[model samples]
Target: MLSALKRVLIGRPLKSTELGEQKLNKTKALAILSSDALSSVAYGPEQILLVLMTVGMAAFWYSIPIGIGVLLLLTALILSYRQIIYAYPQGGGAYVVSKENLGKYPGLIAGASLLVDYILTVAVSVSAGTDAITSAFPSLHAYTVPIAVVFVILLTLLNLRGVTESASVLAYPVYLFVLALFVLIGKGLYDMATGAIPQELHTPVGTPVAGIGLFLLLKAFASGSSALTGVEAISNAIPNFRKPAPVNASRTLAAMGILLAVLFSGIVLMAYEYGIAPIAEATVVSQIAEDAFGRNFMYYAIQGTTALILILAANTGYSAFPMLAVNLAKDKFIPRMFTARGDRLGYSNGIIMLGICSILLIVLFGGHTEQLIPLYAVGVFIPFTLSQSGMMRKWLREKPAGWGIKLAINTVGAAISFVVTMMFFLTKFPQVWPVLVFLPVLIWVLLGINRHYGAVGEQLGLSTGEPVEVIEGNVLILPVAGITHVVEQSLSYARSLAASQIIAVYVPFEREEEAAFRDKWSKLHPDVRLVTLHSPYRSIIQPLMKFIDVVDRKAKENHYQVTVIIPQFIPKKGWHNFLHNQTSFYIRTRLLYQKDVIVTTVPYHLKK
Candidate 1:
């Protein structure tokens, strides 16, 4: 039933032979890997405007300057991450680069920050997408959380289908969004060139507040940095590309950066030229589209695509976060189960976990993109800084061919990223306190996981290659319901296991019941002794556990082991199980926890 359900939800499972998933070519790779960066053009400009709006309309033009700064930073980041792809082909991106070139905690800091940022990315993206939906159709405003959660679920199922499958499914919506933005930019450009001058958008103007200062511009720059969050994804997932993985990954990273540059700068420029502002009811992108295309089918089409790509942009987190988690697990920083592949050859645990987290964030913030907006960039920029710094270190230490040029680029990138990271932290401080608190706790968790795995390895003696010592003698204890075929078989099997002693225990609630049990037990009292335990309160497991405890203590004193053999009858039909009280399970569960006690369940299938 479970297998059938899984097949129904995610399609049939592929064979192990088929698990070597088809390698992603550049185009599909961009669509699959670049959705987050590409889709951010939808909201990245608005995030900038949201900051600048604090200073009023006069300060809005600063978006052009802030955006130019962001693009230059993006260029440095792209250059540094491209080097990261080649240097670390095993695909740790920032975490590996930093862990290897920088110190231990630095790498951990990168990992934890990226982990948090990816979750924030999902929350921000889904909420923004839902905003787009409400923009197009305002009636669904009440169902924001539910709608966002449903989208998370839908994306999860699609991702579980497989990467190539999810990528294919997501590609069209992304393409549509990019095309819409280009058309918006092209038409806006034509208007400027032809002297048709697009007018400022005033309809549905939300909250007429405005202010401007250095602080506000700093905030805008930090917020707009979400566009750069997914830039490292392709670098981290280099192995997911076809042969010549590094080269393919490098080209894909370049392509993603170029697309992000065009779409992001184009949209921001258009908004600035068109005088679009942050509105309560509609987004800056939506407002720009309305001004450029008017309220027509094309306007609605662009809005639809925006909503889609926004929601699916969470795919960036889904695609990369799990792989990061698996790497952490490999380093013994997390549970090893994360390192296992899903039936679809994706990081199944990672994908599902990302979905669950995104759903939680969606519900927690009530699908308000703005409420969670302040915390978004804090997670991304720290890793950016750490990675570039690590790259600089990698070059200085190795001094490979062209290392001189690479080192200079990395130093510049690192310096810029470091400043952006600090700005993000200060700008989003109290709003981001939870994330700041979460990072240290996450590192502590990684350490704790490492300790536990190490302790388990030691206890299991996996490090020493020594054989486990076995107890010298064997004593068997069987709890019986009088003497039946089940008990008879259990005792016979117990005797066959080289049992030095075998005792059959019968618990009775009353003296009369004990006498009757003894009378019936006398018929099979040929070999083992029958010990009767009386329970005044009618607690079966409690009394049976005490007897096992006494036996285990005695066995330890004698340098031996006590085996508790539980004989149970399996019902022919499943419902028959409900008719039984499951006393054997209770006694076995209690006894298994006692030291020096061995537990064995012998099943007898009922014929009728």
Candidate 2:
């Protein structure tokens, strides 16, 4: 039934050979990979307005400068990641690139930062999406957290179904959002050019702008840089692309950069041109929309698309985290489970983990995008710095064609990203220190996992082909309930080992049952001796354990090893196992720590 549900929900499990069939083309890849970058445009402007509003109306004018600064960083990221795609064509994100060039600690730092960033991407995106809804209908404000969580679950489920399915489900909505925004931008531009401003524009008269300082401008710039969050996702997941993965990934990256620059700049300009103040529950985007088209159907359409693309943006993390986890697992930094693909040939475990983490953040932060914004850029910029530095190191060492220009570009990018990293580090220290705290802990964890795998490999004698064995006096003890065909089979199999001794012991609940079992057992097994154990407490495992302990004590004197064989009856159906006492499992679990005493089970399948 579970398998059927999985098949129904995520489609049939694909074979390893069918992997290539699941690769995504450019258009779908852009939608799946670029959602986070594009969706941030929805809340990126608002975050800036949020911080700048605290400084008063005068600081509002700084939005353009801060926005232009972020766009410059965006341009650098686009160029840097394009180089990354070509250099590490097999989808080497910051983790792989930095680890390969910048040493292990730097690589691990990059990996941990990206991991946290992806989690926040889902949280912030879903929260911003919910804000769009709450903006539309104020009555739904209280349900914002729950709504964000539900969106995470839905996005998680969609991603688990594989890339193609999710792209198909989400691509149209992204296109619709892009089209609507461009329409709004064009209409807004036409209004500006023709000098036809709306007369009934309703601007909420906010409290007068407060005192201003350089710190406030930095705060606003840090807040606005969220538009750069999803920029690296495309570079991180090149393996998910179609043939010519690097070429196609680079094209998509370029397209994403152009689209984000146009939309983000346009939205911020529109907000500033119309003098859309940071109002109550409504967002700056919503305010701009209403002023541009009023509270009509077109306004609702843009709001609807905005909500969808924002929620779907969580898919960016869903795709990247799993692949990154798989990479970490391969390096023995995390558990091996993430290395396995799901039914739909996607990294199901990683996707689910990302979703849960994102949901918890939403609940903890009360689904507020502004609250998560400060912590957002810290996770993002660390990786951006490391990735660009990794590329710089690569170019200097490789000296390929155009390496000089590439190195120069990556150098500037690395410098800018490092500055941004310190900006958030100083500005949002209280909130972002946890990320720094997690970095060394993540490195320690990776080291521990690598140590564990090494120890297991050594213990297994994997270095050599053969294991040295010394024969000892071995005794086989069959733990049976009563004389039956299953017991006979276990006894017969135990005899094949040619041990020093073979003993069959029966633990009975009552005296008569013990006597009857002995009488029946003596007639059938004349060659083997039958020992009956009587328990006063009527506990099955305790008496059996005592018997094994005695046997082990006796064997110790004789320089022998004791092996306990339990006969198991296999139920025809999975549910039928619940009907039995389950003593077979109990005995094995109890004997796991018995040194020199081996416990084994021989199963007899039941027909009905």
Judge candidate 1 against the unseen true structure and give its global Cα lDDT, from 0 to 1: 0.84
- Residues 560-604 of candidate 1 have per-residue lDDT tens digits of 888889999889988899999999888777776777578999898
For every candidate structure, what is the RMSD over all alpha carbons to the true structure, in angstroms? 3.3, 3.6
The 0-to-1 C-alpha lDDT of every candidate, in the order given, reads: 0.84, 0.86
Best by lDDT: 2
RMSD of model 2, in Å?
3.6
Model 2 residue 106 CA deviation in Å:
1.0
After superposition, which runs of candidate 1 have C-alpha atoms over 4 Å from their true positions? 198-212, 462-470, 481-492, 495-498, 524-526, 569-586, 604-608
Report backbone clashes per prediction: 6, 2
What is the Cα-based lDDT of residue 136 in candidate 1?
A: 87
Model 2: colliding residue pairs: 56-209, 56-210
Query: Clash pairs of candidate 1?
Result: 54-210, 54-211, 55-211, 55-212, 56-210, 56-211
lDDT of 2 at 599: 84
Indicate the residue-level lDDT of 389 in model 2. Answer: 95
User: How far in Å is the alpha carbon of 228 misplaced in model 1?
Assistant: 1.3
